[model samples]
Target: MHKKVLNRDRASFFVITLPALLLYSFFYIYSVVLGFYYSMTDWDGLSRKFNFVWLENYGKILKNKAFFNSVTVTFRYAILMVVFTIVIGVLLAVALNSVKRFKTFFKSVFFFPAMISSVAVALIWDQVFIRALPNLAPLFGVANIASPLGNKQLALYAVLFVNLWQSLAMPTVIFIAGMQSIPDELYESAVIDGASMFDQFRFVTLPYLVPTITVNAILTLKGGITSFDYAKALTGGGPARSTMLIGIKIYIDAFGDTPKFSIANTESVLLFLVIALLSIVQLTISSRSGVNKA
Candidate 1:
């Protein structure tokens, strides 16, 4: 009777999960396999027939200077985004957590930007950079200041600023949660030991938030690499391609006037590999840190 019931329970579980498993296989597994196959071909994205020039697409991408430049831009932006997001997020979270009154209201206010779509944020910021800031410049005795989006030297930073504005909400929330998760006894012990506020934060709070930092780092890094809407809606890789991130480069290669779908797919595969590798490294480091802390 027990054996029969176990078999029946296993069957029921499979029946319930089969649909989701099938969807995953179709959407994720099958699409990835198909994309990998396409990456080795010379398909122009519209042709019914194509030759598989195995690994040639990968070689071409390696030699392509534009692709390299995009990768460089992406890494630079991603590193900056990760660093700034952690720092500002922790600071903002600490501030919000310290608030005795209106704490919930403050968090909601800060998170409001994230509720808006990226394209909408970019559009609104685009207007601010192009018209509002430029128009208001003369009031400060400055005349004819060009928008950062139109300036090659400052365009990337401008885009980073806008992206960071919207990206902070979730990280801040995570940091706040991390702070809250720390036991009151820890803070009480520190107080009894005569530790200053800064000392308590450094020893008690920061040590506890290492895992939170790791989580935010991975998220921000991925978001920075995959960012497309802001670049598209705000500058469109404008001025002189100063803000031509890898995602935008892949997109253009895939759907430009001369579409190179194979190359685009190759880039996508490489990007996936990069993200996976980085995430693994992050997790490994985090695990080591946790072990050490324990």
Candidate 2:
């Protein structure tokens, strides 16, 4: 009787999960398969006369200078964002963790940016970069500079600055949580051993925070690579594609005038593979470090 009841429960669980499984398979898995199929076609995104082109789109993308430039810009953006986010996040987390008064208030203040819409943040930064600096230029004895987004040389860095500011909060919170999880006894023991605060952090806090660090690093890396809204709203990958990223390039190819469906799909496939490979590498490094620390 117990065995029958167990089997019934298992059957019910499977039945309950069936709909969600079906939905995921249909929407996500099916789309990926279709996208792969489309990548080999010469579709113009909205036509029925599409036919398979067999690697032409892939060749075109690989040969396109603008596409290669976008890839380089995307790589640079992701690397810098990841480095700064991790460093500043760890610093802010340490500061917040060490603070005794109104810690929650500070955390809320720091995290408020993360809650704001990306478009809103971009618009606000756009105005600041365009107007606020010029208004203060005379006082600083400098000429009014156009918004960085309007300057080809500065646009990408401008976007990077805004992206970093918007992204810092989540990693900050994660690091703080990691630091808080470390037992006070560890620090106390370090102090008794005549260890300085920095030493304590280096030896005790960092080791304890490895798992959280890993999580935040991976999240930030992916977010930086996949960032599109800020690029779209702030610069629109403007100034002769100087600020173009892989995400924006993909968007333009897939949806802009003269849409190239096949090339867009190829770009999407390449992007997925790049991100997946990088993520795997990061996880491997993190896991190895975790084992060494253990």
Candidate 3:
């Protein structure tokens, strides 16, 4: 009877998960396989006849200076995004967790931006950068520095700033939960030992929150690397392609006026490999650190 019950439970679990598994396989796994096949071809995305060019697409990528520039921009954006988001999120989380009044209200306020569509956020900020800031600049006796989004030197950072407004929300919530999970007894014990608040945070809170930070770091890093909507809508990879992220470049290569679907797929494959490698390295390091801490 126990054996029969175990079999029944396993069957039920498979039944519940089968649909989702099938969908994932069809949409993601199948698409990736197809992309690999297409990457070796010279398809213009709309072509009926195409020739397989093997690794030629990737060879072209190596010689493409614009592509390399996009790579540099992407890594720069991702690194900055991950650092700022984690640091700011932790600070905001710590502040909100310590507050006794309207804590829920503040969290909601911060989290609200995450609910808005990235394209909508871009549009809203574009207006602020174009119109509102210029109008208010004179009041502060500051020279009207018009449109950072139009300035090649500042466009990338401007987009990063907009992304942070939305991306900080989830990480902050994660940090808050990590902080709250620490038992009150630990704080009391620290106080008994005459440890200052800073010491308690550095020794107790941070050590305990390592796992949470790892989780947030992976998320922020992935988001930064794959960011496309804000770049597309806010700057259009403009100011002479200064903010042309890898994702955006892949998109334009595939869909822009001179479509090169083969090149785009090759770029996509390279990006996937990079992301996979980074994720593995990060997870390995984080696991080792966790084990050492334990």
Candidate 4:
């Protein structure tokens, strides 16, 4: 009877999860396998008959100056986004959590940007930078206040600023939750021990939030790497490709006039590897920090 019930339970669980598992396998696993194969071939994404040229796509990426530039821009955007978001997120979270009045209102205000679609956010900022700023510049007696998307020197920074604005809410919410989850007694103890707020944060609050930081790091890494919609909607990889991130480069390679599907696949595979490596490195650091704290 026990064995029969156990088997029935297993069957029920599998039945419940079967649809999702099947979808995941079909969409994710099969697609990855297909992409990997395609990455080894010279498929033009149009011609049905394509030749398999192993490792050539990968080798080509190394020598491609445009691809190298895209990588540099991506890393620059990711680092700036991650650092600014962490600092601003923690500050906002701390303030919002500590406040007594209008806390709910402030939270909603800060998170409202996140509720907006990325495309919409980008468009809105695009208008501000391209239309409004230029017009307002003359009023302020400022010269050359044009769209950063059109200026090679300022395009990347413009994209970074807009992306940062759009990406803050989730991390702030997570930091707030982390702060709240910490026991009140810890803060009280620190207060009694004559520790100021900064000291308390360093010793009590910061230590407790390490796991949250790890999760946010991974989230930011993913966000930074695959950031396409905002960049596309805002800059469209313009001003001589100054703002062209690797994701944009992949899209252009895959879909542009000369659609190099295999090259796109190669870029995709490299991106996946990069993300995986960064994730592992973050996990290692987090684990080591946990051990040291223990």
Candidate 5:
């Protein structure tokens, strides 16, 4: 009787999960596995017959200067986005936590951008960078400051700034949520002990907020590195590929012409490895920090 009951439970579990599992396997896992196989073969994405090119595609990526530049751009965007988002988000969260009036209004105002479509956000920022800035330069006191997007020297940073502006709100909300979750007594106890505001923040607030910070940092880093829409819609990785992230480069390589499937697959593999390694490192660091804090 017990054996029959156990079998029934197992069957029920499988029946309930089967559809979602099938979808996941077909769409995600299957594609990933097929991609790895295709990475070894030099096939135009549609071709039925193509030569297997072993490690040549991977070698080309390793030797490609453009690939290195893309990697650099990815890291640059990720670092800037993570730093600015965390700093600004934490500051705003702290300020908002202390506010008494129009708190929800202010929170919604800051978070409004996050609710907008990324492509829409990118297009709006593109216009501001390409058209509005040029027209408004005189009002800002420097008529010589051209659209930063047009200048190769400033284009990538310009994209980074716009990305930061759109993204900071989510982190701010997360930080605020994390802050609110902290026990009120901790702050009260610190105040009673005559701890200065900064001291209380450093000792009491920061240690507790570290987990949220870790999660946000990892998310920002991954999103930055894999960023496609903003770079695509804003600059199209223009001014001699100055703003080209790895994601864009991979797209260009894959479908820009007769699809270089093997090369693109190699790039995809490399991109996945880079992101996976960084995520692992971040998790390790977060774990260590949590342990130390405890």
Candidate 6:
């Protein structure tokens, strides 16, 4: 009877998961395999014939100045986004957790930006930066209110600012949960011992938050590295192509000017490796640090 029950349970689990497994194989797994295959070929996404050049395309990417520039821009954007989002999210979470008034209202207000569609957000901000800002500049005694997206020096920072604004919701949620999970006894004990709020946060809160921080950091970094929709809709890689992310570069290579499918696939593969590497490193550090204690 026990053996029969175990067999039936295994069969039920497989039945429940089979559809999802099949979909994963058909979509992500298959697409990743195709990307690798094309990256080695000289396929321009057209023509009847092309030869595989193994790693020649990968080597060319190293020598490509535009590719290098895109990488630099992505790093700048991701670093700033991760830093600002984590700081802002943590502050909001802590403040909300400590207060009893209008908590839900503030939470909803912060998270609402994250819920908006990226393209729609881009369009809304484009108007604010390009049209409204210039018009308002005169009233503020400003002579020239140039569009942020049109300035080569400031275009990357503009994208970073907007993206940071949109990406704070998840981290804020995670942080509140992390803070709340600490036993009330710990905080009470610290208070009785005459420890100030800053001391408690430094010694207790931050240590408990390490895992949450790691999770938010890794996810936000990946989002910044592969950002595309906003770049396409807002800057269109303009102002001397200053704000082009790796994902946008991949799109341009595959669809604009010269359509080189293989080159785009190569860029995609590189982006995948970067995200994967960071995830592994973060998980490793998190595990070594232990989730519960400092």
TM-score to native of every candidate shown: 0.96, 0.94, 0.96, 0.95, 0.93, 0.95
What local distance difference test score does each model get?
0.91, 0.87, 0.92, 0.88, 0.87, 0.87
TM-score of 5: 0.93
Name the best candidate (by TM-score).
3
lDDT for predicted candidate 1 compared with the true structure:
0.91
In candidate 6, stretches whose alpha carbon ends up further than 4 angstroms from where it belongs are: 290-294
Q: Which ten residues in a row have the lowest lDDT in candidate 5?
A: 285-294
RMSD of each: 1.5, 1.7, 1.3, 1.6, 1.9, 1.6
CA lDDT of 153 in candidate 2? Answer: 84
For every model in order, what is the number of clashing pairs? Answer: 0, 0, 0, 0, 0, 0
lDDT of 2 at 34: 89
Off by over 4 Å in 4: 138-140, 290-293
Q: Which candidate is the best by lDDT?
A: 3
Which of candidates 1 and 3 is the stronger one according to lDDT? 3
lDDT of 5 by residue, 1-294 (tens): 999999999999999999999999999999988888888888878688999888878887899999999999888888988888888889999999889999999888888888888889888988877677777768888756577887888988888888877888888889999999898999899999999999988988898889999999999999998998888888899878889988899898889867787788888888888899999999997977842464
Q: In model 2, what is the error at residue 224, expressed in angstroms?
A: 1.3
For residue 191, give model 1's deviation from the true position in Å.
1.2
What RMSD does model 2 have?
Answer: 1.7
Task: TM-score for candidate 3, please give it.
Answer: 0.96
Cα deviation at 76, candidate 2, in Å, is 0.5
Model 3 lDDT per residue over 115-172, tens place: 9988999999999999888998889899885899999999999999999997789899
- Model 1, span 1-294: residue lDDT tens: 999999999999999999999999999999999989999999989889999999999998999998998998889989999999999999999999999998789989999999999999999999899788978878888877788998888998999999989879999999999999999998999999999999999989998999899989999999998888888888887767789999998899999999999999999999999999999998997877741365
What tens digits encode model 6's per-residue C-alpha lDDT throughout 88-126? Answer: 888888998887888889889888998999888888888
Which lDDT tens digits does candidate 2 get at residues 53-166?
888888988898988998888888888888888888999999998889998899898998889988899999988988797798788788875678888888888998998788
Better of 3 and 5 by lDDT: 3
